[model samples]
Target: MDVDLPYRLELISDLPGHDERAWQVAWNPTKPLLASCSADKSVRMYSYRPSDHGSKSLAFSHMGTIPTGHTKTVRSIAWAPSGKTLATGSFDSNVGIWEREDVSDSEDAGETAGDWECMTLLEGHETECKSVGYSSSGTLLASCSRDKTVWIWEVKPDADFECMGVLMEHSQDVKCVAWHPSEEILASASYDDTIKLYIDDPSEDWFCFSTLSGHKSTVWSLSWSPQGSYLASSSDDLTIRIWKRVEEHEWKSVLELRGHERSIYSISWGVGKGASENLGWLTTTGGDGKINVWEITEMQHTKDPLSATLIARISGAHDVNDVNSVSWCPRLEHPDLLATAGDDGSVKVWRVVPS
Candidate 1:
């Protein structure tokens, strides 16, 4: 089988905002907006739209900052599928929900702007909250923490949220929680070196359907494929593992990508216009301060177990700092675009151009 080789991911620009480590970055699902959280105890949003004047280079302008009510570091952020709401998890052991409000002024000639307001605070975790995520339908929210538990919240009408259930399966700290791309299933990674999958059935309720246990160390982050069939996890074991669903409630590791010189902190899968039968492309960042693009061919990965290959790697991606997170632009117009954050307190954007 022929493959696309030697993909080039060129750095477009560095977006500086935070005074400390930027822990996570997320792209809005339906808008040209990007959100990031940092250890500085603040949240920042940017307005990003590629120029149509024939230049492929990208630029992001600082839109505004939200002085989040949290007293500690904001570790993770996720935007609702409708791009109308944002959720942030913090070390203060609270989750803040932000809603976008339209701003208008007569002196500005009736032009409109966006103002994000802290709508409500969800508090229940015993310790630091590490990650927060919203389901594809935006009706459910998930958060995991150092408390070794994952909490699912039901988004009710009139700015009300209730804890639907709590998952306490991981013996160690839960690092991240990600919802499936299409389904209501949820996956959480933990320091117990395992990934647990959960589903909500009307009769069975929310229960762990399967446990993916193969990583030798802490699983730091997870990213599900666009079709919700495959999941990629990065770990302190210094590798990125790809798990493909075999049975309806079972999954197995099909490939282990071992190239990062240090702990792999985050991984993100690209999104495009078509339903890719393969894994398409994935980007991973780690303590080594490098970003690697892996081209995956899962057509026979269920039986082959060696279907992914590294196509491009950018060294010193965050300049000697631990790169914390990596995410691909979700917009259909710029699927090849990527975003990365690091301990150096900067967010860099790149274009993964295929050769």
Candidate 2:
């Protein structure tokens, strides 16, 4: 351990209930629950509480397990802004919508937790669905697939979804889809080494407004800055590119971050401790088994639009197992906390502590 580092990752708990490789982990936006999906075709939920008053550490306990009912591996999971619904993307070429039914009796005077049920299953993708995401307003859901397409769905009441549009502009497999923090803009990364941005035109249908090309290899994941002014993408080229929105529908690469030795699988940008300034932190992990945290600062009155400083690095984060996913806790009060899923089928909670 390097004491001179500005920050360090302190392990809080290792959740080892998944029977196969854990693909993704997501934190609830309005609740204490953390969800992880695995190649075992199951989704595991965990709830956390602070160890003590104003404590930085959290005690996590397994809440429940959902045997997703997908015939293939569950590749990705996402939570809606309200934390009331969960979306699961599976290799079975389908997406599953899950929600907990309130079974608490009104006469009991105490609210009882309910079991998670697969409320709806969305089918369309010809191949595996790689990622799923909900818009900031929770009115729409977007999913991408290995079929080289991105599907947008209008989220209606009563678990009903209508297909808004099917985008087929990508030449290769679509790896990830991310919605802007406060806007309806959507970005999708692909195995074709490019990222495409889409917006629904009021007079017309949804269309790709811009295509961003820079990565020399597959673009694996995408994350938007806390304010949605910038987008960060990780790629098989072993580098992360930060794209800044210059014009209304135009984005250009502002900076490239290099540290990981292998393909970066996941990247998450969040308001981590620096929320006051509106400059968020970016966290990344990948096949090199390392986890990195960078403090992103916006530059004013300079030619450069932004800068990134590597504040913390954890090598062999999963003990030689490739880290598949990394997600920051969405709650503003717990900005220093993050969760990661690994190839070892384990989900771990960590807190960023000052050295």
Query: In order, what is each prediction's RMSD in angstroms?
Result: 3.6, 2.4
Superposed by TM-score, candidate 2 places the C-alpha of residue 186 at a distance from the truth, in angstroms, of 0.5
List TM-scores for all candidates, in order: 0.93, 0.96
Look at candidate 1 and tell me the lDDT of residue 51. Answer: 58
Model 1, backbone clash pairs (residues 3+ apart or across chains), number: 0
Top-lDDT structure, candidate number:
2
Error of 1 at 121 (Å): 0.2
Q: How far does residue 29 in candidate 1 sit from its true spot (Å)?
A: 0.8
Ten consecutive residues with minimal summed lDDT in candidate 1?
103-112
Which candidate number maximizes TM-score?
A: 2
Q: Report the C-alpha lDDT of model 2 over 1-355, residue by residue, as the tens digit.
A: 4566799999998999899999999998877889999999999998887767566667888878999899999999999997889999999999999988884434221124788899899999999999999999999999999999999999999999999999999999999999999999999999999999999999989999999999999999999999899999999999999999999889999999999999999999988885476477899999999999999998888888898988788988889899999999998888888999999999998888887
The clash tally of candidate 2 reads 0
Please list all clashing residue pairs in model 1, or write none if there are none: none
lDDT of candidate 1 over 1-355, digit per residue (tens):
0134567668876889899999999988776678889999888887765556657665677778888979999999999887778899999999999986774323221124667789999999999999999998999999999999999999998679988899999999999999999899999999999999999878766889899999999999999988888999999999899898888888989788888889999999885322366567888999999888887775543667547767778888888899999999988778788899999889888887665
